[model samples]
Target: MVTGGKSLKKFHDVVAPADAAPIRTSYFIVIFGSAHLLLSQLPNFNSITVVSLAAAVMSLSYSTIAWVASLEHRRHGGSSHVVDYSMTASTSAGRTFNFLSALGDVAFAYAGHNVVLEIQATIPSTPGKPSKKPMWLGVMVAYLVVAVCYLPVAFVGYYVFGNAVDDNILITLEKPRWLIAAANMFVVVHVIGSYQIYAMPVFDMLETFLVKKLRFHPGWPLRLIARSLYVVFTMIVGIAIPFFGGLLGFFGGFAFAPTTYFLPCIMWLIIMKPKKFGFSWCTNWICIIIGVLLSLLAPIGGLRSIIINAKTYKFFS
Candidate 1:
């Protein structure tokens, strides 16, 4: 998320000033340095909720702009736009790797179902019967939102940019500086807010371990120091290797596949105690097998992409 914010800022900086130099260490140093100050002020969970809501609003706006722009570009016969939606032709190994990488991308898009349970936990249940209505409602709403936001942009952007699309779609839209800048600005804000939301769990775990296991005092000083260090470490890592898509692919396949697909099946079996060799049991096992295979194999393509990209990129270039 930090890398995303940095990339968008770099995008804005490059176009605004028409700078020819590549994004440098100084840019990241300044950005992350400023980020430290921003994060330091966000002390508690309640404060971050407002940030998250703000991010959601920005995200909705940006997504709408992207979808609309993509359609307009394609409809108006923009340069580089093509009707060829056929398979990408390449060597067998390359094709297979690209397919795997695409799977990872899909996984990344669809991941975060686990968060539904977390959100559901906060919703009030009925007095007598445990209400699953709220949870399912949330899931349905989330999926609908994802589909609405993703499908049009993915289809129309591909139709417009074809194989020439940048990793960041906003970068591909060169015209209408005000629109692109607005979209990128929101991208930065949304990512910054999202970084906090995602990282808060890790912070909670680390602080719990420190205070309980290591006997550290549970105070603002320790919290500030630990959280600051964590933020710095993440920024350093982001600066060192700026491969967002590859990282998404790797994590989506290796971690999210299991969390989203396999673990749920296992949990279902344990909870329901279904027939040992029933149809439901067999289906769950098949899902588990597929999930396991995806987790093991899909990351290969992501790793390969990382290596290939790394060769052309300097430490901060």
Candidate 2:
């Protein structure tokens, strides 16, 4: 719930919801990728710093991907007009079961993440509202800045640990136990923040059900009731799932198959006319290919570990 809240809220906005889903997903990818850039070299994240770090990251990704997607749309014969429309992909039996193999999950997860917003991101606009600020140039510049910041850090991290790499930065730093503890603390806090931000809407979803179906009034007392139920839901996930890392490892790895890697380029392809598939299209295709490759490898790792390590996977294991 905590991570969900922060993540959800970071991308959350009911008013201009069309942008929310892709923005949220891209936010995760940008942060995830940026953290990797620093992994080999840099100082660890403290609470305050990570907040700023993530914000800049979110901005960069939101801008960069938005620009690239827009450019793709424009080149494809649509005006670079953008709008926020929400869409969801199926996660049930039909398309769901075939995605079970970690290999399968890779395909699914990748597909799912992509599916989360594939329809909207590449679609051209209706000719109505004035466009918002142009983010591509600014965001492109930001990615360059972030990349410069990250490259050195990755090497440093590698230097700190050669063959015997620790699981986290803190574990490797002998004297700086504080750094280790602080980084963990930031991540924990961030997770909580993301959950609250993300799942709060899920709570509202539940609340509406309660108020409408159960005949509760949609006021303070109802809100409290809804919140309490939401809290209970959190407890269940925490207790039942215990740690979500393996779960995310499995799920994130799982979703990566369809979502993180495959879907965007595919969507672009669908909307793209031949004249549009020029240099950037080729670049994105390479990236999509690389991501798909990595995503494929990841699911195998996840499935093996998920099957053996995760008791939760016993149903499948």
Candidate 3:
């Protein structure tokens, strides 16, 4: 959310006249968070279908804009800025850490696995016609779309800018001001939906704890207060840190990698009891080993990056 808002501000600054005052980074984050305050009130995942669909479209739109614009920029020799393919980090250790952090980023990009079961629950099912069949098809299609959206952007953005690209590619592309601004806006919209998607599960857990563990009455009042508080807490954290790449690497590894990479495989091994040393068993074990390594190593790089950035960062700035 903070990154999206910051990118939007950067878009404005890019197109604004030289005399225009620079926007404060914190204010836009607050504005972005405010949108979620209302959105969080949505009762459940099923209710946000339209929002989710819009978000998906916006994601594809911005990704297309990013790579396409980057390709055009490269062809036109858009700027005098030198593109260096060399390592950005000065030391070997730094380079190693960056590689680990990149793994976490890959984990994060596929973190949709965290919500897969919940999404499947929403699908209609029966004894003869199982939800898994449809859910599997949907998951496959979603991954295909993800590949389409991600590959071009990663390749073209890196090709055009090398190590000089901003974490958000829209911010790096300065020409075709209107297009970039629109892409940033698309980012904001996509993030709005994404925030809800990720948060819905957390909201469910919170509400469940309140009702079952604490015996709080299950009602709107409880929902309103709990959900709103969650939104506020996340918003404050986002504003305080506002280190986009570092956060992605950190949470992506520490939190998401297990769920995305290994947990399901573990669950399958336990539930399905795949024959030991067989193809299914071997593949799952391989994934588990890789995911565990990612979980252990990626956060070190991410936290180090965060600490480095924090040395020069100001709260809410």
Please, what is the whole-model Cα lDDT of each candidate in the order they appear? Answer: 0.73, 0.42, 0.89
- Which ranges in model 1 have alpha carbons more than 4 Å from their true place? 19-33, 40-46, 80-89, 129-131
Which stretches of candidate 2 lie above 4 Å from their native place?
1-133, 137-153, 177-180, 193-249, 276-288, 308-317
lDDT of 2 by residue, 1-317 (tens): 32332233233332234554434333433343333222212111222244445645543443343333334433564433443232222445423322333344333322323322322233344556322222344345544675653344344444434334322322333322333333333443444333333344355567779888989877766665556555555444433332223344455555555455656677777686435568867766886787676565555555544444455432211
Model 2 scores a C-alpha lDDT of 0.42
lDDT by residue (tens digit), candidate 1, 118-181? 4555567887656587678767876787788778788878877777776667867755667777
Stretches off by above 4 angstroms in model 3 are none
Give the per-residue lDDT digits (tens) of candidate 3, residues 140-195. Answer: 99999999999999999988999998777888888788888888888888999999
Between candidates 2 and 3, the TM-score winner: 3
Better of 2 and 3 by lDDT: 3
Error of 1 at 253 (Å): 1.3
- Residue 225's C-alpha lDDT in candidate 3? 98
